[model samples]
Target chain A: MRHPYADLVAHAAHLLAAAGLDGDKPTVVAERLVRADAMGHTTHGLALLPAYLRDIGSGAMTRSGEPAIVVDRPAAVVWDGRRLPGVWLTARAVDLAVARARDYGTCTVVIRRSHHIAALAAYLTAATDAGMMVVVASSDPAAAHVAPYGGKRALFTPDPVAIGIPTEGDPILIDISASITTAGLAARLTTAGRPLPGVWALDGEGRPTDAADVLSTDPRGSLLPIGGIDHGHKGYGLALWIEALTQGLSGWGRADGEAGWGGAVFVQVFDPELFAGGPAFRRQTEWLAENCRANPPIDPEKPVRLPGSKAAAGVARAQAEGLELFPGILEALVPWAERLGVAALDGRA
Target chain B: MRHPYADLVAHAAHLLAAAGLDGDKPTVVAERLVRADAMGHTTHGLALLPAYLRDIGSGAMTRSGEPAIVVDRPAAVVWDGRRLPGVWLTARAVDLAVARARDYGTCTVVIRRSHHIAALAAYLTAATDAGMMVVVASSDPAAAHVAPYGGKRALFTPDPVAIGIPTEGDPILIDISASITTAGLAARLTTAGRPLPGVWALDGEGRPTDAADVLSTDPRGSLLPIGGIDHGHKGYGLALWIEALTQGLSGWGRADGEAGWGGAVFVQVFDPELFAGGPAFRRQTEWLAENCRANPPIDPEKPVRLPGSKAAAGVARAQAEGLELFPGILEALVPWAERLGVAALDGRA
Candidate 1:
């Protein structure tokens, strides 16, 4: 059954606050997570709360902490995440970056010691909505779940990067992990009793395996890079650069370092007005978007789509008909959420 | 056959000049092209001489012109390529970007009315060698060859972006097209009597086709994006953003526009000293690279290699035993080289 976005947000916020998180951070995290669900990325939505709670309970990720400025400049800022929730820190970073870009035309934020960022599009929506172009990348220092192109042992963690463009329609977003699949998806599939596509993950012997549970658990099977075997170098190269841009620039530890878990993040924001008027940037993008949509489809019955169109559509549909959640989320959250006295998501508590 | 880098550059220079190119610009083009060959991307190397001549002959690309500043700022610059060789314009842009980045800590350059840039790595090598990180993206204004994820008709080119990280060893370069394969590769494979892997392209009728020649010719079959069907949304998103950054930001036409041949480019250079010291950045990257190299191999017989390590090795080998020419290149250039009175590539006329 579908639930209102606001109710979902409030429900998530209540659970987060009750889990020992302090200040106004819970609201921000809730909004980001609900937005993911709203956009049909339920893997990054409420499913993440359990992990966040676990991290906070173990003191691996602090529930009540703020990022510290490591370096501050008009064009660049470096933030140490201080083990805070990435949503909280990233929201603040986007604000700071947009503010800085207004004056400097471009600004970059390198975040060290950051926690899991969930979905990159959640952070980017704010910046793109503010009429700035955003590019962000993140890599976990320790949570290695992906092997290098030909390597058996995991040295990468999908190393995602995302870019957003403010447009006339919904903001255009390109978010991708360097690996063919993400650890989160593996976990979700495992929970749902599904086998992975045959080429996606490697087992203990570095042979291809379809066991989602084996792929998701600790000492898990490793994810293949985006191109699988033949073109893995492309994805591997992207992952390496993301790692460098995040860790190297932030002075964070390498993936193999002892300090594992919450790692590094890199963000760069540019004011389109720096190069052209914002309107013109929007116009060109709109024109391109129009053409992308108008392009004839291979299946004549199906229309072409611009990037982010589906996610944007998902948001609208979720608003109208409520979110079609990935199964098992509410089931998973219900048990822990009871401790917080947060009862039914239907607001019957 | 082995020829000195200097001789190869000179041979390329002579051919370009003989095609009615004026001034010393041919040397710049030659250097970039030869660098591509040295790095083993021979498709972008001497093999492109015939196209250059044809472009100049048709006045689609001018043999001699200079990039004029469309906008100038300490932190950003926009150039009008004036149909000059993209090699010349890109080299100039790189110099200006590196110079400005030294002062501003970060700098961006956008190029309009540009020609084929050959290889992004060539322009990147200089900045990377100079101890700076560079990000570059380019898209053709009208040379559409890739289909949007759901579309049959072409709405995007390869629309590649490349990043370079200066390191203690080989600069880590990650260059990729938004599509699985590039137009150049399609052309090469067509000439080589090869069939594309089944999923690579869509025929004129929008049916999947394996014939390389069919994909490369006019009314060309459209290329699938990097992710194939299952996740082409990711690649289409990347292409869309590259289009926005390069064409939208540069005030250039979208891929659907009439202005064709070559299009626009975006380049940003960052001095690591902006936030952290360059030495620290290099050290961290070196550490990461070493671990990437030492990662346990799936096939223990073949050790893992870091991105760009193979290309760097190729360059070193080329320096020793010469750049491997695509089998047909020197033969293709022989008649033109004789026309330009430039002979003796490998001491053979």
Candidate 2:
């Protein structure tokens, strides 16, 4: 069952507000959450709402908290997320960084103490829309899921990184998780009681296992790195490096870091026109896109997809025919919408 | 046979000078070349000398050509490598980028018309030494060898990307070829009469063939992307992204664009302390390294190696026990050394 994108967002926002988040914060948070669903990244979308609501309700996440700019230099800024929702804070930080990049040529933002950042691709889209190039990385506490290459225990989060470049028509956005298979995907499989693919994970005994009990493997059952079974070392290396760049540098999440979800996030944005002449940069980026798309595909029939091309196309389709929303998401948001007095979601439950 | 790193460099410099390279340029060019050899990256090392010398002699590359800063912005710079030796220009460009990063907190440098860059790692090491994070990419013309993933025809050079981050002991350097293997490696194996590793490449008909003759296959052989045999699309994606960032943005080489031996390169440098407090950033990076290294190995005997740890360890070993030179490499530099008036190898013919 599917719902319209707006109703899903309205429901989620209503719940967030009912849970104590005030003003533009819920609106900001809901927009990103729904955008993730619209872009088809359900993992970072409303699937996280229940946990988010619980965190806020239990005071693990403070709804009223505002990110503070701790350090503001000409070329960089460090923001204490104040335990705010990562979606809102990260989006704000990236926006500020892009504005600074336009003035300073390049700018970086270090965000500390933020909670579950929804799809990183959202912030990159924001930066690229402003005609900036951006590289962003996120780190979380030892979800204890991914093992370093050649290592059996979970040592790092399958840290996610996103790089976005502005081009004509649609910018190139590359969002990659250092882990071979995303935890969310694995969790979905586990929930569905389906065996994981061979590339998904390993057992405690250092053997390949398809068991859907992903978290049960815990310190023993670990996620494989991106290059899969043999080359996971590369992925492990990349994840650890991202960890260093984001959470490590933010000065938070160090103590008890091996446990749960707290870490740093880093976002850097560049104005391409700062290096290449603006027109040239745009023309060249477009040319590169066309070159790849126009090149004879290895299969000749299949089109070579540029990183963000599909997402942009999806966005277009959503705008035209409404974004799809899952049934679980809608069912979870009904009570909150009633509490927030936001009106029922489009004549559905 | 092992030779002093300095001795090999001198031979390379001398040879280039004899081939009409500017006298002052040889040392930088040679340093980049031999550094690759010293680091055990033989593919990008002295093996490239013959081709480079040929380019210089043929007027495709020039000595005494100074790169001009074409664009200067707070966070970016564009330089015409002026057909100068790639190593010399890239070194200067990256150094300039580091300086800019120090001043601006972040900086990007794009160089066009640069000749063959000996080793991507060399440029990354420079940024790390400056306590900055770096991403570097370079694209070359179709050398008629390394293939795009899944293709029979060689469409581009095995364009490579290297990323580095600053750490306490040694910076983390992760350099990888877009191609699973290099043409030179294939050539070396053929000379040694070794059977090709399974799935490393495809023959003229696009069938999986490891005859090493994949390099000589008519219609030209193509190197598989990084995933080795299956799902090389990931590697293909990475390679295409790097090309877009560097050569694509710089308008240096398009797969079908202007024909030239020279290519474009892009380097980005970021000062971590700029975004994260200096002390916090250092602690974060250190913690990241510790967390990764603390994990127990699956093989028990084989420990996890961080990205640059091997190269740093290799450097230490070379410093103590002297660098190892391949027999073939040592034999090839004699004529060049004689031309430059440098001392020739004692054991070489």
Candidate 2 residues A1-349, lDDT tens each?
A: 3456566676778778888897688888887887777777877888778778878877777688578877788776788887788888888888888888887767778888887787887777888888877888887764557877777777677788888877776888877767766778788788788987655677886666667675675445887776667455557656766776676456665544544354468888777666564566667667656656665555766666777667777666665667766546666666655655666667532
Across B118-194, the per-residue lDDT of candidate 1 in tens digits comes to: 88877788799889988888888868888888887887888988888888888888788788888888888787788
Worst 10 residues of 2 chain A by lDDT: A254-263
Question: Can you write out model 2's per-residue Cα lDDT over B97-178, one digit (the tens) per residue?
Answer: 8898787667778888787777888778888877788877887743545544545556556777778877676777887656
**TM-score between model 1 and native:** 0.94
Error of 1 at B185 (Å): 2.1
In model 1, the runs with Cα more than 4 Å from the true position are A216-220, A255-260, A320-324, A335-337, A341-344, A347-349, B18-23, B63-65, B216-219, B338-349
**Runs in model 2 with CA error above 4 Å?**
A209-212, A253-263, A298-301, A334-344, A347-349, B141-157, B190-198, B202-215, B228-233, B248-251, B338-343
Each model's C-alpha lDDT? 0.79, 0.72
- lDDT score, candidate 1: 0.79
Which predicted model would earn the best DockQ?
A: 1
lDDT of 1 by residue, A129-203 (tens): 889899888888777788888888887888888888887877887778788788888877786788886567888
TM per candidate comes to 0.94, 0.91
CAPRI-style grade of the A/B interface in model 2: acceptable
